[model samples]
Target: MPDLSSFPRHSWLRALRQGLSSIESQSLGYTSPKGLPDARTAVSDYLRRTRGVLADPQRVVLCSGATQAIALLAHVLRNRSVAMEDPGFWLHRMVFRHHGIEPLPIPVDDDGLDVTALANTTASTVLTTPAHQSPTGIVLSPARRTALLEWARAGNLVIEDDYDAEYRYDRAPVGALHALAPDRVIYLGSVSKTLAPGLRLGWMVLPPDLVRPVVSAKSLADTGSSVMDQLAFAALLRSGDYDRHLRLMRRRYLARRNYLLHALREYLPDATVLGAAAGVHLTVRLPDDCDIEDIVRRAASRRVRIDPLSWCYTEPDCAPPGLILGYANLTESQIDTGVRAIAAAVGHSSQVVPDINGKVAPDSGP
Candidate 1:
């Protein structure tokens, strides 16, 4: 989730007004299932300029957020199961299952998805977040990136979920894997994290061969996404307001991330933080004796909502005790309060908290 408090309402309104005034009356009717030409072109330009994605407007299919995009792919590629990062986004796995596409869990390590483990899977399609692995927040190492692409070249498809690539604090964002081999990679991205999820705006830059089937699947899904919304987003992209808003939010989120890190050090000194380099949330690895369920329940009692790390895994028992804390939606004081509450919840643990020495400790267990 993004900082909803700082949503560019005025900018969006201006874009909406411009979109309505400039849109053709003919466009109000059923447009192409691929999406409005302007929207697709705008997305293509933005992605090409920022993420190094090899995007063609003709190959870009806009949908109602990444959720719809995933569903469409599952429908088009339902012949076989898809390989997913073991501690990946849980909701995506559910979406695949809903569309009758079983997801094969592939282990993720500090270097990102284990390409070796993935190579062993029978699934032809693998969904990955190379920029910043979901929940874990580790960037895919150069070696792993090459290995994964090699695997894709061997008659496989890579679903690159460019998740949380916009808010990198430590360095410039990594380039999209799609640029290396566009035909073998299906790039997924949305304003859900940057703008707002309610907009339900997302896009897919598909392989030439997959484009027609995906467009067909999208048509069967909803006849295409909302045209007005798409046009509005196009206006935002064209006018440069979207980039300005991102610059502003990046500063804000960076501040919040820093404060959260400080709060963790001060209040929850025993906990180890991971994935703070990018994304709106960070993972805090708790002591071994800390019961994650009990900590989550106790934190909820304090009116602090926190997601246990185990919830992101396909098999909960395999996940280590930790918490996924989001700071994008909370103020500095709220973050401090929330961290204190979580610290209280974790107070029952008797295991020693090792000094992380200003580095994220590597996980020793699966």
Candidate 2:
């Protein structure tokens, strides 16, 4: 979830009001299943200008969210093995499995997804978060980017989930992988991080060849997304309010991230923080001897909610002991308190907390 407190409530209200007022009486009926054309145009322009994605409105397929977008892809590309990052978004794996498309877990490292290892997989369709990998904030290296593109050109499809690419703090913004090989890459993104996940608004900038199939799949899934909602979002994008909201959020999130980093340095001096330069969450690698479940339990007892990094892994046993701490929803003081609680939890673990879907053991407490 994004920071709801920072949402541009007034701007969204203004845009939505204008959108509703501008809806012509004659255009009240159902529109194209591809979603509002104006919305697509707005998104295309925004993506190109900000993320360097080369998209045309004709190729943008609007869906409920990235989840629905991937579901549509699974439906259209059924029976195909979709290679996803091993310790990737677990929800994606479940979505693919539910849709009857088994996802092949590909290993990811400091350089993002191991393109060399991915090349060895029989799966031709690969889903990757190349910009800022989920759970692990590793950006794909330039050389590996080239190799991935080449591989995609060799009759493979790269599904680029450009999620939360707008929140980089320390370095220059990394361009979307779709910009490199638009023809072979399917770019998917949503306003879930920027605006709100409740909106369920997202898009897929598809290859020219995949547009029709995806559009048809979208049509079958739902007649179309809410026309009024699309119109309001289009207004938000065209009026530049969405970009403004991003700017405000970037500053706020950066502060929270810095405070969290400083707190970690002070409280958990032994822990290693990963992916702190970007994204809303940071992964903290704990000492191997520490029981993650026990620590999580202790933190929970102190009213500090921390997610176990092991939950994202397909092979949790093989993954390093760590916690995925999201600072986006917490205040600076809260983050400090949370880190202190976690540090205490780490320091006092005397028994192994049994993994209950990455939850702390019921008996374990502060």
Candidate 3:
């Protein structure tokens, strides 16, 4: 839910119209597997300027979305084990599993993915969300970043997921890990966050060695992505509309994030808030004794949909309980209402809570 409410409808319509008008006759028939040249160039330039990722247009492969980018990698890198953060994105693990590649889980702490632990694993590849780590929102520290790169250079490969790197609040934006060692890092990003997920547009900046195989995989995946959308995106990028949209949404999301934080402080003050400085979602660490399933049921009963952080783990029973609250798509009032509901669900509020979904029984720590 990447703030679709604030999507620039008028600007996109304008750009789309312009893009369609400018589309050459030949472009309508068939396009390169590497994607529309205009879109690729625009994406490369935008990434280089914003994320400090030195990407060449030729090396950029536009895919259906980031999921497809990962799938393409899975297809190309078959028979190899990939290490992912223990409490990382669940879909990454599922996608790898679908491709017969079982991912080794490396525990992540406040410092981001434990690179030292990753070094000890026999896995040669690691997929990481370093910019603002998914769910945890912990930025990879400078020391860990260097160590991770050193590990990557030592006959290892890194898949950098720059998922929600655009919306940072507290600190200066951290440059993409690809910048440190482009040869070892495969950078992945998607318009799914900035634009609409329905558009299903994404790009990957691959290492030179990977350009051909991934492109071949993509060619077999769908021939190519929708050409019309790519053209419109290129136009949006070229006309400065995309940057303007991001800037506008950044301020709006920051406000929504702040409101949620303030509400949480007022209500669920005991719950620890993580990764609130950036990204569309925030992770709330609950007491270890709390039953996450019961809380989720209670939240659902109240019409508030909150995701359980435990789902991201390979073994849910062993993981600490937390909630991944997405604030970008909800209004301030809705956020307040949702937090109040969660507080009530978790017994944080003094109000006599309803017997909703039966009460959550406490558990002694293992």
Indicate which candidate wins on lDDT.
1
lDDT of 3 by residue, 257-284 (tens): 9999998887776789999888999999
Error of 2 at 169 (Å): 0.5
Q: Model 1: residues >4 Å from true position, as ranges?
A: 349-366
Tell me how many residue pairs clash in candidate 2.
1
lDDT of 2 by residue, 1-366 (tens): 679877788988888898889777655577778887788898999999999999999999899999999899999889677889989988888899899877888898888889999899899999999888997898989888999999999999999998779999999999998888899999999988988888899999999989999988888888789887788899998998888888989999999999998888777767899998899999899888988888899899989888888888888877889999999989987887788778768766844332312233443553
TM-score, ranked from best to worst? 1, 3, 2
lDDT (Cα) of model 3: 0.88
Q: Which residue pairs in model 2 clash with each other?
A: 64-200
- The clash count for each model shown is 0, 1, 0
Off by over 4 Å in 3: 348-366
- lDDT measured at residue 281 in model 3 versus the true structure, 0 to 100: 93
Tens-digit lDDT track of model 1 for 25-66? 999999999999999999999999999998999999999888
Full-model lDDT for every candidate:
0.90, 0.86, 0.88
Candidates ranked, most accurate by lDDT first: 1, 3, 2
lDDT of 2 at 85: 93
